[model samples]
Target: MLRRSPHHRWTLVSRVMVGVLSLLALGGIVVAFAAFAYGRSAARQAFDPLLVGAAQDIAESISIGDEGPVIDLPVSAFGLLSLAPEDRIFYAIHGPDGALLTGYDGIPAALDTVQPRFRDWTLQDDAARFVTVSRLFSERAYAGRIYVTVGQTTRARRAMALDLTRRALFVTTFGGIALIVSALIIIRSAMRPLEVLTRDLAQRDPYDLTPMQADGPQEVRVLVGALNRFMGRLDRQVGAMKNLISDTAHQLRTPVAAIRAQAELALEDDAPRRLPRLERLVWRTRSLGRLLDQMLSRALVIHRIDNAAPTAIDLRDIALTVLDSRDHELLAPGKDVQLRIGEDAVVVLADEISLTEAVRNMLVNALRHGATPVVIGVSPTPTGSAIWVQDSGDGPPDAVRATLGQRFERSAASKGNSAGLGLSIVRAVAQAFGGEMTMATVQGGFRVSLTLPHHGAGQSQ
Candidate 1:
């Protein structure tokens, strides 16, 4: 199976979505980080009130002990922590002597003695986190600094952080998917009018060089209008050209008819002396008429196709038809004519009648000017179709080859009336189809290549 490229599949939509998604992902990352931070702050803020209450209770419960030089805590001290779930509470009291005094004696020291009372400190214990506060009794009765510290475990804070993190991820993952789906829907909807234009265009045939219908957004409407005007102009130009060719043909017919009558009247001379001259005139007149008819017909086709669209032309079938029509011309024994037809379908946007005439003109030129075996081959190149006409003549003189573009003004009134427009017609047709024509000096004769635009006609042929 062959794979269709992304360029051929979803190029426009993918490009649009990539841009939207890049910005959306950036915003999602920023929001996720902010949510993580906010959740952490919430977990921290949730514990602050408990810490303040613990401090106040420890502050109020202190009193002189039964013994001298001491203080005590209320039995309700541990009960302060029971209000908050999963709270790990630790408390300690220290006298001015720096000795372990009351509360959990194993509880570590919490403050610098020189610091003011009511100051709080934080420390990380082995299995718990603690917040400690120190106070001083500066009344005249007792001048000593004592410390009261309160602590709680960090498990609750950590658990709350994990929960917030999950919420952030959950919101972002589902939200991002929703955003993508919504973006697709919006993009397709916004471009829906363009699709209508596409269908309108797809319904048109190659030979139908009609005005494009206008039904789209502002920009597309403008484009369609311009194309329609161009098509209208093209159709008018083609109509004018066909009329011109018909008129030219009609005008030529009158002159050729008059010339034939004059030649026949000249043959009325009973003397044999006038017979050869009269016969030559009649033959030359007939040839001139034939040439004129060919030229006018080719000119009309060229001019029309230049302005209008060309229908699909099967070059392979046309070549075969031409070759079959001229098989005896090419294979007549002793002429040494060669015909090499490659086995591939070469289709192009062209006129079948015009293309056949073009090929016939080439063969006629070869036969008229050169000896056989005239080599005619049809093949393809990198960019287009190429038809070759190589005759076994000495080719044109170097001067004539170099001066091909020069108008043959001096030869217009010649006896044979060869205006050298056969190759020119081929060139014109090629140019109308965005192809090229080239002539190269070959060994025995000349090689003329009538290159036509390839529509990938033989890729799967």
Candidate 2:
């Protein structure tokens, strides 16, 4: 069963858009608050000075007459207040004895301060702002200070503040929209390269395992490079599979035909001649079985090398494993097969199973093709760690040595029984693990070794 992803997947574009919109919404709220405060302050600065000027003009119009203090209620002062034509005006004068001398009778009294003062109050049942001023007279009837209070309704002041706020909100709304549009455009443009890459991969042939073009931004190029490397490994695995199928079909045909032919001849022959023919038929069947087993083993080694991760392994362990299996005693019963390894470890990084198979094949090849007293050992050399099988005889000739590791290239001694796949399996394992298979004429024998790079400590070949 296929597993579903736990998270709700979102496209890259959707994620970027959501992030941009969230930021802009928060910024818009803060900007709206700032604009409202600025509007209120601007209205106050523009109109407060005018209110003070009108109050001062009204103070200059006060005088002492025969009836005590009086006020002319200057037209110039009224004209100055007319700047807000939609607002109502109120004014009042007080005698030195605090009696209402002229103008509106119900105006709120000013505070007892000498400096001009402004205050808020209710006038004619509506909210209003007022300014108060004082003057002193030395006339006979009125020799004390006089006060003049002027006020106006707040309808026009509120309208002005609201107007300024509205204009600011208009500009901010359009600017936020423009920013959102630009962010979307930029995000789509950035994602174009990935879209193109997806399209190319979707349309390519199924069998095509070619490397992709690494283009666009640095991040996109990195993704393409990783994909290319993965495809390269897959291609090698496919090639190996194809080779196995082709080799199986080509190698099995002649041996099967010969075996069938021998069996038919045995069935027709007399009892006296039948024994030899039956023996030959049995020999052919055994040779075919060995060939099939080696072919399958080689295929398995290739598969594991691609899929298995490598680890540090002691070469001595591989040598011991082969010696302990004692399959050699079956092939060459009573033949001398010596295990020669030192106490020190000879370690290399490799797949343990693949290395063991390769070493086992080396021992088998040596036992089959060389003289008696075959010796298997793990030793440290100047170049690398070596697992070797040696026999007390001269190695193959120079011409045969050149072609030794190729599959099905049998030497003359085996005649026709040998499958000639052992050395090829050793070569495959060696090359797969970044190692090499070497054959040399040693002092007392022929030697075949699979030498691999040292993992932790250096060992020479």
Q: Pick the candidate with the highest TM-score.
A: 2
TM-score of each: 0.46, 0.71
Q: How many clashes in candidate 2?
A: 8
Clashing pairs in 1: 336-373, 337-373
Pairs that clash in candidate 2: 381-460, 381-461, 382-460, 382-461, 383-460, 383-461, 384-460, 384-461
Q: Candidate 2's error at 410, in angstroms? A: 2.9
RMSD after Cα superposition, model 2 = 6.2
Minimum summed lDDT over a 10-residue window in model 1 is located at 405-414
TM-score of 1: 0.46
Overlapping backbone residue pairs in candidate 1 total 2
| C-alpha RMSD of each candidate structure in angstroms | 14.6, 6.2
- The TM-score obtained by model 2 is 0.71
List per-prediction Cα lDDT, in the order shown. 0.67, 0.85
Question: What's the number of clashes in each of the models?
Answer: 2, 8
